[model samples]
Target: MLAPLILRGVNFKSGIVQGPLAGYSCAPFRRLVWQHSQPAFCYTEMLPAKQICIEHGAFNRYTSRHPDEVKLCYQLSGCDPKALAEATAIVAAMGADCIDLNVGCPKAKIRKKRHGSALLAYPELLYECLSAMRSATQLPLLAKIRIDGGSNERHNLLVAQAVMAAGVDALVIHGRHWREDYSVPCSWGQVALFKERCKGIPLILNGGISGPKSLHALLHKTGCAHAMVARGSMGRPDWIHYLSGPLEGELGSLSLKQSVRWLKQHLEDLSQLESCETVRLQARSIVPYYAKQLSVDSAHHLVRIIRGSSDFKNLMLSLKKIL
Candidate 1:
């Protein structure tokens, strides 16, 4: 069995964490996860450090955490040291359990700003940014970085060493380069190599962990301290509970009716917490996942209904009909 992770004195009961998914890991989505699945830790969507530093209410949306989220880690991304430090302090003041620097987002827009995985190419700058954030607050600092800018193991190792040397509490490494497509297999061997190189700091393996079986296998294979679940758990909020095993009965025994009830509750919660525009977008994005559980014709019809409806009430009604 994998032991619980202890990062800078905070104890996480499970080794699994919900990785930050930009638009999807917002307040309402997190609330659903906490209420249903109960992952060891959860992260806010990546908020830009520069925006937090410049805009008055920029952190407002990200910081609207539920009371149940005791282990929330607010993730920030930026290339500027000063902005990062300011944002770290702001997040700490907002009662975040930990602060995570996002250096592994592979989006082209993020890379263009020299943020996210772009930092992997600039070791010295990444170290400086980490150091500045470390000095800004006493909160536990975590960094999420890619394996390398390219496929080179040596380069990945050097970056991992530098991240540790800069005083981060834990490291989350995605096992592929930023430029690589998701079709390429994640380098679990490279993740194992990182574990070998960075001995003491807790290494949380991100990417390629789709479900409980893969999570356990990766942990065993890499000797990683923790795993972060990403796209796998998007619409299926119960994934964490399923992985935790204690709630296996709930997942295993859920009938289609029960699943539909759960999906309805999730949609209702999102409607109450977010604006109509957000609800519409979320419905479009998440409904397809739930549709997969239904027959192909029904699923297609349901998606079309969800996509076409602008009103939340009509969308919910149409969804209920399908269920």
Candidate 2:
């Protein structure tokens, strides 16, 4: 159902996309996504406008893109219009295929900083920030936002209108309110409601969509042009292929042998981008996501090995022993 939709002038090879996850959607993981699912393009982790303005080219984990990530989109957050515009220009020069402004992040820390969903409360400022970003680059621009329930619906629509008026190439609408948690269901009605209001602009539906199949179903339900996969790609990087590629595999999960191989490659990719100390600490957290696809005992075995490993090289050796 997802055709190659054009934004500005870039062609997203697939309408399905690997959306940005704050901590998990780093360069190494996205590189793995590209090798497996190859859905449109993967967005880099959310970047702070002020941070990008200060550390545009430095060796930063959040800013590093894999050399193979040809169609990368940079998602930027901040309330400062100048900082966003400057950040936009910097990423554009850094080879961003498209840029997205994160207006839907619901984390309290992000809101308190007036950077994420907090900006939804001030339409005027968001409009200014977006307009400045628009003026910065001819490259495609987008804004991602969340829906608020009941009394706040009108204001939510206003924020959508504001970003559109500011010249975002498209909009990504999350079906839940900023105050709501993921445990709350993603309201397809809310996503459809935004589609009704912003009739002409291209919209990318986010939230609760795990991969291409559900994404296709959501598009039919909401009339959105495309969809973004978030939590669905955790551990199962090969998810999109089940929907559009070979159906021989059940439920899009890789085999345990394949999983171990991919996991090894993931760690190897991280080795080039981050130091051994960073990889060792991060591996403890990353294993659980991969563990999700494994049987309960296998998952536990993987986790224990990663957690008990004394060092980074030990971590790899332990993973190799799993097979």
Candidate 3:
């Protein structure tokens, strides 16, 4: 159902890459993905360039990687080219297979820092940052971006032209504008515009891609060979498998019992990689996502139990009772 993707000189067994999710894309979640559905590559949560440069050796959620991780992309966020360049080299030394610039994040805090979607408006500065990072390492450098909405071709093209001119290896374009929410349908038409201007750079389509139907549709419509999944894979580590190839059984989220088992291991891995407080907090969000497979009343009951749990032991106990 998908083609093998080769970024720079690295060969990904499959072309369906895992998108970088903020808090959830850390070591434990990625470890689960590796054990369940290994995609072309998995991305780490966005790492602030300044933070990386400052705490280069410290172990934290953003910079930590599991021993099982093979093809990993370290995503960096910052406005200064020099700082981004430094951080790129830092991640390279930390063993990154790819370096991605977070140009698509739309959060107000990110925009306030002149990073993320804000960079779309400053094509020259974006070029400078990409150019600097490109020179900093020999790894494949990708810029993850979104369009400027319908009828805003000029702005979208400018950013596309800037990345290409700065000599990026590939373009990972999401189908929605930064201002829009996920409820708004993804605009494959705008992604097609980028495919036309790409010249030859490999374009990876992202946004609203949940399964084989959506994945195949995006590829067929926009002519992109690769796609990334975000919310679809939350708490369901096996979500990527359905898109990687043909499936024989039930689809989407795993059965309730199976999901509860997966969540047990996921929290265990999270405990090893993060603090006790992190495990408590992450369990709250993780349970509800995986609980979606249950009946509505059952799911609500499980989520309520999980959120009210006081500690790691309580969290595990609540999850066990679900099955």
TM-score of each: 0.89, 0.93, 0.93
Reference-based lDDT, each prediction: 0.78, 0.80, 0.83
lDDT per residue for candidate 2 within 188-266, as digits (tens), equals 7766556666766788777776444566678787767687767777687776555455324358445666777777888
Alpha-carbon deviation at 170 in model 3, angstroms: 1.0
Off by over 4 Å in 3: 151-153, 247-253, 318-323
For candidate 3, the lDDT comes to 0.83
For candidate 3, the clash count comes to 0
lDDT tens readout by residue for model 1, 1-323: 45677887878787888889887787767877887776778999999998887773343556677666658999999999999999898888888788899988889999999999888888889999999999988888999987753565346866876787889988988778877876677877777667776778888887776556667778778766587877766666777778777422344534455546656776776666678677777787787766776677766776788788878888778668856
Q: Which model is ahead, 1 or 2, in terms of TM-score?
A: 2
Question: Could you tell me how far off, in angstroms, the CA of residue 115 lies in candidate 2 after the best superposition?
Answer: 0.8
Q: Itemize residue pairs with steric clashes in candidate 3.
A: none
